[model samples]
Target: MTEEPVGTLAGIARHAFPKAPMEVLDHVDVSVEAGLAGDFRGAVKPGGRGRRQVTLIERGDWEAAMAELGHAIPWQERRANLLIDGLDLPQVAGTLIGIGAQVVLEITVECDPCSRMETIATGLKAALTPDWRGGACSRVRRGGRIALGDDVVILDPLQGQLL
Candidate 1:
């Protein structure tokens, strides 16, 4: 069988937490401003309505690997589903990219992980530590709907415009 040709940036993995599935969203709305992903009073999941939890991306995380491994070697933070490779997104996490028909978000900020992942990854901390070093996070820019097989198209990459 012929493999489907992925466009410019490869869409490696598509993921959603057990509590929050992509289907819960209708269209991801990424805000180009005002987003946070670290521990704060208003950043917990089971908190009251005004605040939410901040997301994370480890350097060698499995989620980063599933996105793309073509560049920057295999650091844990690189295993994200929507690999916005080559873009320095320090202040742009709350934005949105329309992936094919759906919108894959870039909403989280970096939050370093502690010992919990060691249990989830089954004692792979030594191999995964480097990946977690470069952490990541995201917020629901616009929550509506998303799913697997959705194509990812970077609205604006790190290097300005594509040649």
Candidate 2:
């Protein structure tokens, strides 16, 4: 199958609070069981099924969202695990994205902005509404360490099939 287009991992952020400032990190560990190391979402669920092991946002989308709001806002305020560049983060579910050398994430759903966003900035929630601006929630498939500047690759299931 043909390989999907490549992108870049621009940044990484995580926080312990549901509505607190995200702490940017140079590198973070990702695993099927715990998600990002120390990330709040890593807490085990009773059934061992958590779709939000990690979250990712496209830098382009973030910039567009900010421009639509008429100002710049910190990336941390979005509360995503990774900020990616040069990829159009498909809104479709079941998409698989490979981060760095070993981490693989299956896109589960759109990460809708919550009321907490409004707390981060006025009009923030509304600003993040269109074009999957808020980002995507994913579950870790294959776990590994991810760092800034890692290669982001999309894995299209229909790669070699005739449409």
Candidate 3:
């Protein structure tokens, strides 16, 4: 028998720049707990076999992460490939992030951090905000893959609650 995940899709990558190269992502990972991420892959680029990873942005770490890339890009100004505003990964593992008439996803395993984040956003270790900053990444369990301009909707919340 298998168990189900919890939580819902609060928000998705507010902005997605599919055209941008992997240099944009400082770090990527998967998370399980409520406030902390689980595992991470760091950068999002070429060279992954079957294990894909999710990118993450620490609170104040965004600035430093951007700097390491030799660009003055601001954190808020960045267009992440996939943005999740709220909702815990572990809590909402089975939930789906619904977009208008297109893609949806079931919460898979928690995404943890990889090497890129350690190098770029070292400050992230100390700057993680509970409510703000940024949420973690997720694997697309169902529906089509997400593209730009897709609207996200949370299918559930903590304890099957809806907001």
Q: Pick the candidate with the highest TM-score.
A: 2
lDDT of 2 by residue, 1-163 (tens): 8655789999999888665568899999988888899889865588876788899999988898888778788886788889999988889888888888888888999999998888777888998888789999999888999999998987755661211
Runs of candidate 3 with Cα error greater than 4 angstroms are 1-80, 85-91, 128-134, 156-163
Model 2 lDDT at residue 2: 65
* Model 3 lDDT per residue over 1-163, tens place: 5433323222222222332333333222223221112222322344432123333333243444455455554443333334433323333345555533544444543344334333445544233333323334444433333333334455553443233
* Alpha carbon lDDT at 53, candidate 2: 82
The stretch of ten residues in a row with the least summed lDDT in candidate 1 is 30-39
Better of 1 and 3 by TM-score: 3
List pairs with backbone clashes in candidate 2.
none
Indicate the TM-score of model 1: 0.38
Query: By TM-score, is 1 or 2 better?
Result: 2
Q: Backbone clashes in each candidate structure, one number apiece?
A: 39, 0, 28
lDDT of each: 0.36, 0.85, 0.37
Models ranked on TM-score: 2, 3, 1
lDDT of 1 at 46: 46
What TM-score does structure 3 among the candidates reach?
0.41
For model 1 the local lDDT of residue 139 reads 48
CA error at residue 143 for candidate 2, angstroms = 0.3
